[model samples]
Target: MKKQNIVIGVAPTKRSFLSMEEAKRQKEKFMAVIRGIHPDVVTLVDIDDICENGILFETEKITQVVEKFRRAKIDALFTPHCDFGEEQCAAGVAAAMKVPTLVWGARDERPNTDESRGRDTQCGMFACTKVMRRFGVQYSYIWNCETESEDFRNGFDSFIRVVSVIKAVKNLRIAKFGARPEPFMSVTANEGDLATKLGVTVVPISPNTVAARMDQLIGENSPRLQDYVADVKQRMDASGMKEEAVERAAAAKLAIQDLMEEKHCAAGAMECWSAVTVLGAPVCMALGELSDEGLPVSCETDVNGAVTMAMLQAVTLGKEACFLADLTIRHPQNDNAELLWHCGPFPYSLKDSSSVARLVQGQERFELKKGPITVCRFDDVDGKYYLFGGEGKGVDGPETNGTYVWFETNNWKMWEEKLMFGPYIHHVGGIYGNYKKVLREAARYLGMIFDDADEQGVYSL
Candidate 1:
């Protein structure tokens, strides 16, 4: 997971209106709240001891404080709600940092008193919004309602969104096992381009080196691999797959440890199709286990998919997730439906497969029979909002293209109608939930086209 340093910005209230003690207490309380959500250093701008209520919003004061926050390298800025006039200061600091800004406001609920406080607080938030608009900056908002009120749900939601924003700004490290052979255009990516645009560093390693490291796991010398293989086998046993597939899966599991260390990768994309298959080893099963273990593997050395999956893993904190999908037109009766198929080796736990393991005519050949799965991913169009979608649970269609994993969600509509740009893939896998916005922001920072603007238009994949 990517960790980031967050800087909380605060300014002293004007003394004529707020006593020094009261101002300190208010600032402290707000800072405490922020720390509870994300513990970090708080930078007090110390603009003034106290000001006339409107003075905090003064252009000069705002500019000075904003400059200080920028120098601090704040990932996100949180400040108390203020009148519309005072909002530009916060917006200016956010613009300077080019980071997401959120307004922290207390939502009182004491009947008449509550209404007044809420209105005042919301006004401050609206003021910041206007400043952001004026500067053409993007921002988010969070409100902390009275503890007793039911508004805690929304409060938590906003806070999580802030967390997502932070994750995106922080650079993610992606490991590439090796370059793909020619003819796989969809998967090749320019690492220099990725670093220049998204802040991601592509850690590359030779496939030959990974192979040499795996050899070390063959004997009784590698205790760590032995232990990991045993533990992985235990998990596979609990999965109830056949004995052969399970044992092969275990070996593959051990191999991942060898590869990650040898490659020095936080996440990996593998090309085991030729090597393992020719050697009569279960490469697909191992890749699936590696993905299930949180080191996502995009098959056929798909670099973009590796980056996309890594972004999702960072956002989801390495929970159950995979990118199992394909893009094709749905049938007339299934316009709302899209097929979720896997050409990679998937564990039996991900889907139910038949005992008869054989090569499908069109799909990639595999040793273990594939099964059903949940499918989800983000679809992006540059300079536009992204679409998040999923088709949950279903059997394979009777076609050489492989299995069908069904999913449906209104989240697609939300992406189309709401957020700008998102993460998506022509290839999909099953594991965790969609980190739609997280991937989008990462792509924005990397400056890569998340998806072709004319994807649905004339173009060859």
Candidate 2:
């Protein structure tokens, strides 16, 4: 997870009847709020310096402020109107910086009187937006007037999460091993489109290369391989699995880890089923371990799934591990709930408290913990990429086999309809949290279609 550095530009105007003192005071309050939420804020131009009676009225001051933001490596920009804002100044700064930008203003005081109330920040925001458009600058805005209110806070927080996703995807590199399983054609991705539009680079690794790495590790009895084998034994009760299977699984884990480090890759997607037969063991537990360690590995060589997992990891700042599963079955007891299951690749930390995750037949199997979860996918329709998500909760269900979770949504039928008719497949990424809003907002910021579900119904943009 990368820390975001934001630059805040305060806009005010001498033309407004609002006093300079009041404008300066409001600017300080807005700055304080931002500082509380994000400590790394670059306010290069001080309120006092920008405002004699207005903010950044002079071109020379705007240039200086832009230079400061450039030098600071600012990730995003925010301009809050303290009074009737200087629209040109705000637009000028945003155009110069050319980053994700936001514009907002304080609500007007009630009972407007000629002497007591004169700040028309609402009107100023409109003008600011127009100028930004004329300059061909893309930005976001808080529609509400109350900057101190909860609505504004929510918007700001969502913006930060959106920025985090953008930053994570901009320079992302994924290690793709082999091809997607021959039968599962739905998991295919457009590698060229991903690189052209999202700045993602896929490093293709041959199956023979991986096999050679695994053989070398086993033949040399590498220290890291030995340590990983011992650690696996200490962490998992692998008595049910064959001794040879355990060793094979350990070798597969070392091979993947070594390749990831060698390639300087952030995430990976592997042809798990074929690799299982070749290695004489399943790769589920090994992939799960990598996900737990903040390096997400998707099954079936689903490159897009790996990208979605990486986005979720960044959204959570790597504090939580994400699971990749097939929307396998509908719950037997509840029509509104469905089963999210994989062939035993979920992290051990996500296993339900009632059941311990165990290595059986070379795979770890357990029910997921009951809690709020966010289900999402990054998929494309005819090469146009989109993000789809919904919020649900893990519930109790009958355990069949493999890693599973009983996920219940408010409108399960609607969700199912969307999945069937929309540009998505059976595979989805699951993480513990109600991050539907965050994902939706992020999709909007990234200019991708967001298909989201909530209490009201399913909606898409």
Question: Which predicted model would earn the best lDDT?
Answer: 2
- Span of 10 residues, lowest total lDDT, candidate 1: 359-368
Each model's TM-score, in the order given? 0.64, 0.89
lDDT of 2 by residue, 1-461 (tens): 23333344444333244567777677666666765764453333344544464355555577776776676677777777877777777888889988778788878776468768667778878888899999988888888457688888877766676666777787689999888888998988999999998889999997668778888887898888888877887777788877767777888877887898799887899899876656656788888888887778899999999989988876765567898999988999899999999988888888888886678876888888999999999999886888888888999989778899999998888888788777788889999987887787767767688877553334545
TM-score of 2: 0.89
Once fitted onto the true fold, the runs of candidate 2 whose alpha carbons sit more than 4 angstroms away are: 1-18, 38-57, 145-147, 454-461
Candidate 1 deviant stretches above 4 angstroms = 1-74, 82-85, 104-119, 133-137, 142-170, 181-183, 237-252, 258-264, 277-280, 326-335, 343-404, 409-425, 429-461
Q: Tens-digit lDDT track for model 1 on 1-461?
A: 23323354554222223243433445555544444553332233434433433235445665666666666655555555522225655666567666655555555333235334223455556666777778877655555454233453344334344444345424556667666746666565666655665555777766666555455555445677657556655433323445444444455556665567565565666665654543235455566556656566677777666655555554544434455445443433433344455664443334444433332321222222233333334333333323243323343243433333444333333322222234444665444344443444434443434442212322222
Q: In model 1, what lDDT does residue 100 have? A: 57
Position 43, candidate 2: lDDT: 35
Clashes of each: 35, 0
